[model samples]
Target chain A: MRLTTLQKFLWAAVAVALVAVGAVFLLVDRSPEPIAQAAFRPTFSLPDAGGRLRTPADFEGKHLLVFFGFTNCPDICPTTLAEVAQVMDDLGDQAGKVQPLFISIDPERDREMGLAEYTEAFHPSILGLAGDAAQTRAAADSFRIYYEREANLEALDVYAMSHSPGLYLISPEGDWLGQFTYGTPASEIVADLQARL
Target chain B: MKRIFATLALIAAAGPALACETVTVGPLEVSQAWSRASIGTARPGVVYLTIRNSGTADDALMSITTPAADMPMLHQTVMTDGVASMPHAMEVPVPAEGQVALEPGGYHAMLMELTQVLEEGETFPVTLTFRDAGKVTIPVTIQNIGASEPTCPSPDE
Candidate 1:
C-alpha cells in the first residue's frame, strides 16, 4: 500500500531515532576510560631469597605476575608456575619487562632459601618471596587472596593447603590490571601482556 | 592365504605407529611416565602417566613403589571453588578398553620425603602393581621443573 506523506515522514523520524540510539549505545560501550584499574597500589614488603625485605616498588619499571602459593604444594603451584614460565618464554625479549613473583603462604616451612630453590627451578628470573604469618596474612588480604590450611592437617610433612589459584597481573605503575583464572593458556597471557605493554 | 599374508604385513607396518615409550604388561599399556624435578632432597614430587587397558576386564592400580621417594603415595588433586587440595587415593580404576590419564593438576603419585633430589634428564624406576595385571616396572623420566605435559618422541621417527 502506498503511504501518505505524513506517514512517510513519521517512519523516517523513527528510523533516525533508532540510529541515534544505536550510536549513543556504541559510544557508551566503547568509552576510553581505563578498564578497572586498582584504586591504590597493593604494597608488600616481603622477604626475598636473601632474607632481605623487598617491596613491589623495587620492580617499579616492570610488570609483575604475582601468585600466592606454598613451595610444598605438589601440583597446582608448579602447574601455574610452569604456565608463567611458558608465557615468559613465549614473550622472548619482552620477558625482560615482566617479573613473576611467587609468594609462599606457608612461611613456617618455605624459608627464604627454600623459596629461592623452588622459584629458581621454574625460571631464573622468577622471584620467590615469603613473610611471617602476619605479613603473609596482610599480603593475602591486600590482594584478596583466599587461603587456608587444610582442616584435617595430617602429620607435619603431610598436610595440604587450600588456596586461591588466580594470578594477579599488576601493571608497572603498581595498579592491578586484571586477574587470570586458573588454566589460562600461556599464549593468551602473552597476548594480554603484549597488549598492555 | 595371500590375503591373510597381506593383512599380517599391514598389521606389522602399522605396529610402529602405535608404539610409544610405553610398557605393556598383560592388557595394560602404560606410557609417558614422568615426574618433575624437585628443589631439595626432602620435598615431595609428583609422578604422572597414562594407563590404557585393552583387555575386556577392568583393572585397579593397587600401589606404586619407587626408590626415589621414601613414601610414595597415590594422591589426586581436587579443585573446589578455585582452591586446589590433594587427598590420598587408595587406588585408581581403569575401565575395560578405556584409558586413565594421571596428569598434572589431576590424579598423580605424590612422592613424599624424596630420598634424592630429582634432576632433569635423570630416570628412575617405578613399579606399579595392578590387581589383575600383577606388576610392571616403568621408567620415570625426570622432566624440567616447569614441564606441565609429557613429551614423547614420535614413534615413527
Candidate 2:
C-alpha cells in the first residue's frame, strides 16, 4: 500500500527535525567549557612605591592593568609601559576607573633604583609595586609569571632579568579576565577596556 | 664642476635623512640605528639597527662599544612558551648577501650601566666591531622612552 503525498512529506519533516536536534546537541557538546573563575583568580600582597602594602582589595572597584618587569629592562619593558601610558591617556576621564600596576620582578634593585620614578615617567597613575624576594616570588607565582636573573661572568654585579612579558587584565572583583601579549597596541587595549568598563 | 656641485647638493639635501642614517664599512651596511631615551641614569639603554651584508662570506658582529654606556653587549631576547629571556649573544652572524635586523623583541645592543641618561632627539655614536669589517661607528638616534620604531624626521620637521 503506497502512502499519500502528505504522509510522505510528514515523515520527511520528522527526519529533518530529528537531524536538527542532533546537530544542536553535537555542537553544544563540542563547544569549549567556560574557564573556571577560581583557578584563574590571582592574589598579591605587595608594597606600593610608598612602602604601603597593597592588595587586590585596595582597587576593589577598579579594573586592574597589571604588568611584570624591572627598571633595568631596556627594550620590552619600556615599550610595554609606553603602550600602557598610551592606553591610560586614551582612557581619559574613564582612566580613573582603572588602576595600572607595574610589579617589579627584581625587587632588590628596583627598590634602590626608584620604581616610583620609573613608573611615573610613563604615567602618574601607574603604581610601581615591589616586595622582598619571597613576596615577589609568591606574587609572580600567583600571576603565573616566570622570571630569572641572567648571570654574567664578565660583569657579575650587573645582571639582566628574563621574565614573562604579559599585560594581564583583571576584573574589578580580582578575577583574571585575560591578558594582552607583548606588541598589543594601546588602541586595542583601550577598546577592550572600554567594552568591559 | 657641474657634477661635483650636484653631488654636494645631494649630500646637503640628504642631511635631514641623517636622523636615520646608514653607515657602510667593508661589505656591511648598517642602517636604521636607534635607541629609546632612558628614564634615569641608572637604567640600561638599548640600541637596534639593521645590518646588510654585500660580501660573499658571512661576517659576525663580534662586539659593540658606545660612550652612552660603559658596557655595551650584544643580547638577544628569546621567547619560548610565552616566556621571555634575554641572553648575552657573543656574536650575531650577518649571513652572506643577507640582512640581519636588530629590532625590538629580538637582538639588540644592551647598554649596561649607562654613563649618561639618553635624552630624546639626541644622537649617540656606537662603534660596532665585525669579524671581517673591523670597526665602524654609527649614530643611533634617541627616540621617545617607549619608541618601538626608529624615529625618522618628517620632511616638514
- Highest TM-score: give the candidate number: 2
C-alpha DockQ for predicted model 1: 0.24
Write model 2 residue lDDT over A1-197, tens digit each, in one string.
Answer: 22244234434433443444455446545865553456588889999888999999999999999999988888788878888888898898899999999999988889998999889977799999999999999998888666765432223344346677989989998899988998888889999999998
Task: Tell how far residue A33 is off in model 2, in angstroms.
Answer: 13
Measured with DockQ on alpha carbons, how good is candidate 2?
Answer: 0.22
- How does each model score on TM-score? 0.79, 0.80
Stretches > 4 Å off in candidate 1: A1-41, A152-156, B1-20, B153-157
> Which residue pairs collide in model 1, if any?
none
Worst 10 residues of 2 chain A by lDDT: A1-10
DockQ for each candidate?
0.24, 0.22
Error (Å) of candidate 1 at residue A7 is 82
